[model samples]
Every structure is written in C-alpha cells, then in structure tokens.
Target: MFSIPLVILVPSAYGRMLLRLANTVKERSDIHLQIFAAGNDWPLEKVKEMTEAGIYKGFKPFEQLKSDFQQADAFLTVMSFEKAEEPFMKTSFTTKWLDYVPYGKPVFVWAPDYSTAYQFAHQHRAGIAVSEDDPVALVKAMIDAASNLETWQAACGGARKAAETVLNAEKIHTLFVDRVNHVCRQSQDTPNIDDLKELAR
Candidate 1:
C-alpha cells in the first residue's frame, strides 16, 4: 500500500510524545505506527527502569532487523550527521539514518544540517524530511508523510533492490576464494618448502 507505516527507531521515555503523536497520525492519515531499535542500544541497567516506567516500547535484534525494517514504511532517526555547525546541532554527530538505508525505507530524520543520508534520500525520491527541532514540526512532517506513502513505497522498493549489492554474499565469497589463491601462490613461490619441512621432520 502507498500508505506509509510510521516506525519510531529511538527508544526512550522522551519519545512518548512522538508515540502519542503517532496515534493521531494513524487516526487522521491511515498510517501504521510501531517501535523498533537495532538492539537494546540503551544501557542494560536502564531496561527494567524504562519499561517499568512505560518508557520503552520494544527491541529488535540483528536477526529480526529485516522484519523490523519491513514493518515501517518510514524510519525516524534523531541523530545528526553534521559537525561543524553547533547551535542548530547541539550534540549528536552520527547517522541513525544508515540503519534503515538497507531496508530502502523512507527516512525522517530530526537531523543536523549535514545529514548525507537525508540529503541522499531527498535527492533519490526516498522520502520527505524537515529541519528545526520543534516537536510540532515532527507531527506536521508525519501528517505530510501520512499521504506520501505511495512515494515512500517507491523509494523503499528501490532501496531493497540495491541492498543485496551492498550486502553481497557472493562478493564476500569471492574474497574468501582470493585469499586461498593468494596462500597457494605463496606456497609455490617458497623454494624447497617441502624439502625444508621434510629435513625438519
């Protein structure tokens, strides 16, 4: 379906408002909403504390990563990939956006100015995004996103098509074969390698 699925990729009590906002988007826009993270990136000591306080939603392991990616028509990453700029960015300097790129999902990042993934997605027709840190802006972006599922799906499809090339098993297999060939060539180059081995024996 062209209708976008809204998936929150961050895990925190601070994210509750976003979760509440997702309910609104679902009612108003027909988008599905869920929660996810690559793993319990949050500290283990805080797990029970967060869940007990109703601050945590759920966690997905690397094995289940593919399903989690598929569950969302869109992914939200709250980190920044920009560094030189300070005031607009504050602290984060990483791309949470990369985690979802393999799924080829549309990404919505509350990111700093230099988000290469956001810019790339914008250029590739993967999804729409917003700047500024206002939570209201996030909700509005969600509303706009609610209707752009068709566009989001197209981008995701393209992303999935390219995932295999980047996660190439055969290319990895070729590397393994090349290593064996290199070792064989080295053995052949060694003069009296077996003779020396026999003398030692």
Candidate 2:
C-alpha cells in the first residue's frame, strides 16, 4: 500500500483555540499535542515545547486529520455539554471521532457535559470522557488508556463496532425504509382539521 509522508489533523480554528486552552496546563503532562494547520502560521513550536519536547511533525491538513484520529495512538477532544435552557453544545460531538474510526484508537474527550459522543463512548467503551477544563483529567486518562494495550485495542474494536452499527449500506437502507414507513403512517394518521371542525359543529 502507498503510505503518505504524514497525517494532517485539520480542525476548524475554533477547535484549535480550544485545544490551545488545554495546553495552558503545566508542560510535560501525559497528553501530547501535534498540530497541522494551514491557516495563519502561529508558533506551533510553542505547543510542541509545551507537550512533546518540540516533537511537532506534520504533513498536509487532510492527511494529518486522518492520522490524528485513525492512526494516532490516541486522541484528546474538547467537548461541550447540554444545558437545561441551552441546546446541546455543538462541539460535544467532535466530528473528528469519525476520522478515528479506521484506527479504532481510544479518545480522551474534554467535554463540559454528558453528550452523544460521551454516551457513544460509554456504550461502546471506545474512549474516555473528561471535563473540558480538566487538563489533568485528560492527561491522566490518556496515560492510563495508553498503558493498557488490551483495553486500548478493545476500544479500537469497539470503535469499529460503533461504525458497523451505523455505516453499513444495509443498515442505511434499513433506516431509510423505517423512516419512510413512519412518515407514511404519520401521513395516514394525520387528522383533517376542517373535517373535525365540521363534525364537531
């Protein structure tokens, strides 16, 4: 197979900024961050120095995005939560989880609430969910997950399992069929307002 030079993990600027916030913790933490950005050239070396002793490597954005999740040994994600008055936080899902599907690597999520991804992770045992401001929690989770190879591999298996539950052509077809059936049922059951008013009067 043709292997590329490197994998580029390209998230939006908002995500990058969120990630930077995690780096505010003391350096030499268990979690190490690698950057692959094509936007304004910030001093990523600062990130490298803070995390992995200046081992900042990269390729293109697309490739890095893949390796960052899939081939990456692990991941740290920033997640939001579902508030009572507010809607579920958008960042709670982190589409990056989709990229990690191929590698089946375990993820360390930094989220503020119990979200869909958090539920998915627990359901499939695919990753560790942490509080967004808890960098210590993220690092500790990453370290523990890394140390347990069997557990990590199982998480990968679980990730693939999660995908199979939703990604198969047959599964999609079944969902479409079910949705159409429900819609048809609803249409049949929808009451005619005018007819009801006339009958009542």
lDDT leader: 2
Cα lDDT over the full model 1: 0.53
- Per-prediction TM-score: 0.48, 0.60
Instruction: Encode model 2's per-residue lDDT on 1-201: one tens digit a residue.
Output: 111111234345434444554354335554445544443233666555533543244345565365445445665555443254124553345566655555655565656545666666776666677755555565666667678878678766776775677534467689999999999999999889998899899
Q: 1-201 in candidate 1: lDDT tens per residue?
A: 333333345544325444444434444434444544433445565555445533344655656666656666666655432343444345333344445667666666654445544455455544455665565676677666556767556756755643455434566578889999999999888879678898898
Worst 10 contiguous positions by lDDT, candidate 2 = 1-10
Q: Candidate 1 — which residues are off by over 4 angstroms? A: 1-33, 37-55, 80-99, 157-201
- Give the clashing pairs for model 2: 7-63, 7-64, 8-63, 8-64, 8-65, 9-64, 9-65, 79-110, 104-156
List, in order, the clash count of every candidate structure.
0, 9
Model 2: lDDT equals: 0.55
